[model samples]
Target: MSDPDADDREGSVPEAATPKKKKPKKKRAAEPSAGGVAIRAVRLSRWYGKVTAVSEVSLHLGPGIWGLLGPNGSGKTTFMRMIAGQIKPSKGELTVCGEAPFANPNVLARIGFCPQEDSLYDELTGLEFVSAMAELSGYDRVSAERRARAALEEFGLEDAMTRKMGGYSRGMRQRAKLAQTVVHDPDVLLLDEPLTGTDPSSRHQILDALQRRATAGALVLFSTHVLPEVETLTDQLLLIARGQVVAQGGMDEIRQLLDEHPHHIRVQCERPRELASRLMTAEGGIVGLSFRGPDVLEVHTWQPDETYAAIGRQVLESGMKLRSITSPDANLEALFHYLVQRANRGSGMGADAGTGAGPRLQSAAEKAAYEAQLDVGGGR
Candidate 1:
């Protein structure tokens, strides 16, 4: 695993200037500048004894909703803990807003963290717990009360604000925890599985609130096993597998990477008998081929480039008509399965869950959003 912090370290390396100087000095501009921070992790890593919880993972997140995606035991929670400074990493450095996050008052003051575990005081009413968090975040008494009430309203929890958290259902409790996380109006928001146990309606409300926060310039990041949620909410994705980042960047870019990788190719054409006979007689020979219908030819080949080229040339040379030449298995799900399978086979960790479950399809509110996008003539 590569160190997360290492990404910025190479910036410190100096190139020799055109003119010689009395003493060679490293160029400071080569390194990433400091001052404002949404979040920065340099070679950040954590381990529990022999089992590494989070490998050396480095990431820089700006002011936007970024998705932290991975399966169980992939270190999403561990990494979030390190960001809150609750758990120190075994090696590497982590900084929030240009300061060490662990036990750093100034840094903690500007950051809001909603841990995966339920942390509400069982005895306290929702309002009391939220007020407490506001105070801890340094809000004045009057302001804390006002802000807590307002946050509850935003989450559609105004009615439940006075109810004891212990009696609240799982969905209600989750919303209460979320309200408290943002009571102080922190500049950076970190949420771990914030949508878990939440109903479809509650999830939409939370996601809406998160979007508003990010649009207001807060650096918001969240962890989830839900793929559709990630795809819909945020374009930027950090995909982790086995405690290491296997993929990152926007969804389209990641999809492009998968397309570039070598995989089996399946082609269907108009002339099954002719195409199969020609392919089998060609130099590469068909890896596998079958006829699904009278005119439909299913040609399978390990070499994508070779098969496509041969098929194209055959069409041109033999004057054979062709239909669709689609790769039936080319998709994100296939790519995800391949990567997970590869990691499992290589590491011998069959015990690890294969892949995280994607979120259920959009709720009614989400469907409205999707329709809105279409109304604006937006691409999916």
Candidate 2:
């Protein structure tokens, strides 16, 4: 056995042996700066005794309106709770206003949290609840009520401010909650489904207030399943699924991101074969092609917009008749679906975890997997 492959194993001689390739040194994850109104999570994770709610997540956010988009049960609530000091992270370093939030009085005082559930006191007037909330933020009786009225007016609850919460509609109650949340005027705001049942008029007013808060330099992080709301509220986006961040970016960054995935586009034209042939070899971005009909071709490409543009140009240049081009998965829902599916299939999306605001490094929290046994076993 030694004689048979000895020459190949040693490259014919010791001096002729190939040099082993050295592994690339991993970069250290950068620490998020702690100052002003900001929230930073370094591989932040939360577990509830056998259930992993939020897994090794990291992000560095500053004063702005950052949309936390995720479907129901996507751990958005748990993540917000962690930042709001309601629940301590099982493992990882999380900082709100530069301090660990859990059980930290100063930090808690500086943070405002609005949970998804209805937490209003039924018998208390909308003004009373908001005033109580202000008092909890350390204001005295006179100033608390004063700020509460102003906050209520700002959130469009002026007409219902004196009415008992039990008599309030869902939208009115939501406004009361918002009024309370802002009565303290904390630097960091965490709102979970803040616009749940609000009508158009109320939604506009609430959205306007949030936009103002962000413009005023408060770090507002709100979670919602509605994609358009995120686009409407802020260009900043942090999309999460399965308790992990799938992608995050502004409009420009998102467009650049789409280039990294294959987008299938259906092309309807007079000559499908001619268009397919022209696209099959266009300086290389096309993944594959399928004929859907006599005048239709479904093209899979890494660059959809570019491919679509090229198709349009070719039709004009060759005098070929073109009908229309369409992408079935160009929307946010489809984008999330595609990314999650790829991550599940081990396409390196799971391995590539990090916020653009921070370096992508294997977190120290990875070694804490032994703590996984304590998790409840299913993610929120």
TM-scores for all predictions: 0.68, 0.77
**Per-residue C-alpha lDDT of model 1 across residues 1-380, encoded as one tens digit per residue:** 33322322454322332232334463212111244535766456688999988765655666778788777887888888888878888886778878888987777877788888865688999999898898787654555676788777777898989989998888888888898888877778889998989988888999999988888777778998766776678877666677765665565566555543454545555566877788887755356777777877767555666788888887777777677777654544555555556554554232222211112224767534433322111111
Q: Over the full model, what C-alpha lDDT does candidate 1 score relative to the true structure?
A: 0.69
True-vs-predicted CA distance for residue 335, candidate 1, Å: 4.0
After superposing candidate 1, which stretches have Cα over 4 Å from the reference? 1-34, 258-260, 263-334, 347-380
Give Cα distance to truth, residue 311, candidate 2, Å: 0.7
Please provide, for model 2 over 71-184, each residue's C-alpha lDDT reduced to its tens digit, 9 standing for 90 to 100.
766688999999999998998889888899999977888888888897678999999999999878866566677778888888888788999999999888888888888887
Residues forming the 10-long window of minimal summed lDDT in candidate 1: 371-380
Candidate 1 collision pairs: 4-43, 4-57, 4-58, 5-42, 5-43, 11-31
TM-score of 1: 0.68
